[model samples]
Each structure stands twice: as structure tokens, then as C-alpha cells.
Target: MDKNTIEILFSERKKVGLNLFEIMKEQGYTKISFSNRVKISRPTLNHLFEGEISSITTFEKYLDRIRDVLQVQEQEFLIGRRTAIGELQVAFSCNEPKGYHPGEREKEMFEILEDLINLCDFYY
Candidate 1:
């Protein structure tokens, strides 16, 4: 492939990685849980999502397993429809009511935030 074509291919692969990560989250899968489900190490899952994978075979294995678990069509996964967020830095400051106890929403928020931060760290 020409230089431009190679760049486009890499860009699409990065999109696929991001989309797969989102699909996992939407389906209520954590890195550990999803890695276990896919029979991949947590680090491997992390690399795959970060688009830092070096081996095509390894990438295909993860993609195949994820595609099966997500029940998404191959085309949809490979050519992900969701636009990849270029770069995002989100900050949130919240205080609960004085007498209020945290609930499921708060717990979920914390978990999601942790995951998002971990994901962001991969790009740096």
C-alpha cells in the first residue's frame, strides 16, 4: 500500500479499537471481566483497545472474540460507525448532599470514570 493508504488503514484500525472498547462498556463489561470472557489477558485487552497491538493474528483473535460476544456484524466492527473522539479531557467535581448516601449511580460513575482514565493514559 502507498503511504496514504497505509495511514488510512491504520486510522480505521484505531477506530475499530475504540469502537470495540465502547461496545464492551455499553454491554456492562469491565476490563477484567471482558478479558476473561474473551480469553485474553487484561494487558492484551488494554493493548488492543489502545491500538498498540503489533501482531495481526493477535488483533484478529481479539476482534473475532469480541465480535462474537457483542453479536455485531464484521463490517460494523471493522469499519466502525462511531466517530472516534480525537482527544478528550473530562473533569467532574461533585458533592453529595450532607446526609445522602451514595447509590448505584454514584458507584457506576466511579467505575466508569476509572475506566475512562485508564483508557486515556494509554494515549500518552
Candidate 2:
């Protein structure tokens, strides 16, 4: 992805904050409740919802918890067309990279997100 595409993806991700917050609200998750459910500290959850760009690992775990609690499909948590390859490249370039771990839970969650993205690609 080029610089312009990266810039556009970052802009789109910022725009997604409101929609993601709405989804949490729709699921009836108070900040405290969401923190407890997701096993993250309240302050951390606050940072995430307040548009702080957290580690991909942290975000992935949160997304997993949100999907599990809401009983929603993986696509429901995705940012859709806003997910440009540039944004993915940025995420992939995180300074503190996490190697793939095929623990059962991790594998399952990865597969779920992968499948959702693949399905979404059909419409792209």
C-alpha cells in the first residue's frame, strides 16, 4: 500500500470510532461491564473506546470478547470497506510484533476473522 492509501485508511479508522461505540451501546455494555467481560482493565477499555490506537493483540482480544458476548458474527465487528490493505500493513508493522501461536482459542479466533474477511472479499 502506498502513502496515500495508508493515509486514507487511517482517516477511515478514525471515522469508525462512533460506529464501534454504538455497537457496544447496542449490546448494552456499560464501560465497567465491558471491561469485566473482556478481562481488560476499565482504564484500558476507556482508552480503546476513546480512540487510542492500541496493540493489535489487545484489539484482537477485545474484538473476540465483543463477538462472543454479543453472539454476533465476526463480520459484525469488522470495519468493512474501511479495511484497506494499507491499514492492515500498518497493523502488521507494529513494533512489538506477536508471533502466531496456534493455541486452540487463538487459532479459532484467527480462523473466524480470516473467514469473515474472505467472505467480505467476495463482495469487494
Candidate 3:
């Protein structure tokens, strides 16, 4: 989309880390443990979370597996829902920007983030 929408999207994407951290704690999983259990290498998981987009193709495989494990469809979890996590009542997922076509790098990263958000919702 336009520059303002892109900026907003990027801003929202960063907040998923807290959601993820909460989810991991709720599920009793460390990064290493989660990676191993999910059959995704630690570095790949790191890359996905850190927005490192060099391995986009490889990321899709891991994303699919993550989605399967989370039992969430790719397009089904981005809506704003109220999920209680301790005292935090954050939106269950980020608001996706409409009519936006992300670049190769961002496309991969967004997909990963979206699936992970869904995974977080599933876990919590």
C-alpha cells in the first residue's frame, strides 16, 4: 500500500514479540525447546522472528509446519480478537493492511509473523 500504511504495518509487526513471549511462557517452551519440538532449526525460527528474509523459500516450509501444529489456517487469524493473557488484553493479532502487496522479504516475514500470532492464540 502507501507509505503510511506500510509504516503502520511495520510498527504493528514488532509488537508480536511480546505476544510470542507470553505464548511461549504459557506453553512452557524455551526457544530451543520450541524449535526442536517444531522441527524447525533455532536459526530459522530466529530468522523468522527477527525479520531476516534471506531464506524466504525455506521459511514457507517451516511456516506450513507451524500452521499445521497450531491448527490455524493462514488467512484465518489476523482478525482482532480479545484474548486474556494475565492482565494483558492485547488484540489477538495485528490489523492487516488492506491492498498491500509486500515485497519478497516482507512477504515472507509477514507470513511467518501471522502464523506465529495464530500459534500464539492457539497456545494461549
Query: Best candidate per TM-score, number?
Result: 1
Q: Which stretches of candidate 2 lie above 4 Å from their native place?
A: 1-16, 78-124
lDDT of 1 by residue, 1-124 (tens): 2455434435567777787777777678887888888888888887778788776655666676877888876556455545466545677656777998889998899889888887766432
lDDT of each residue in 44-105, candidate 2, tens digit only: 66556555754555555565566677676543433533333323321122233478545788
**Candidate ordering by TM-score (highest first):** 1, 2, 3
Worst 10 residues of 1 by lDDT: 1-10
Q: In model 1, how large is the Cα lDDT of residue 114?
A: 83
Q: Provide the lDDT at 113 for model 2.
A: 73
Kindly give the number of clashing pairs for every candidate. 0, 0, 0
- Between prediction 2 and prediction 3, the one with superior TM-score is 2
Error (Å) of candidate 3 at residue 27 is: 3.3
Q: What lDDT, from 0 to 1, does candidate 2 have?
A: 0.55
RMSD of each: 8.7, 18.3, 18.7
What are the runs in model 1 whose C-alpha is more than 4 Å off?
A: 1-11, 78-124
Q: Which stretches of candidate 3 lie over 4 Å from their true place?
A: 1-26, 76-124
Ranking of all predicted structures according to lDDT, beginning with the best and ending with the worst: 1, 2, 3
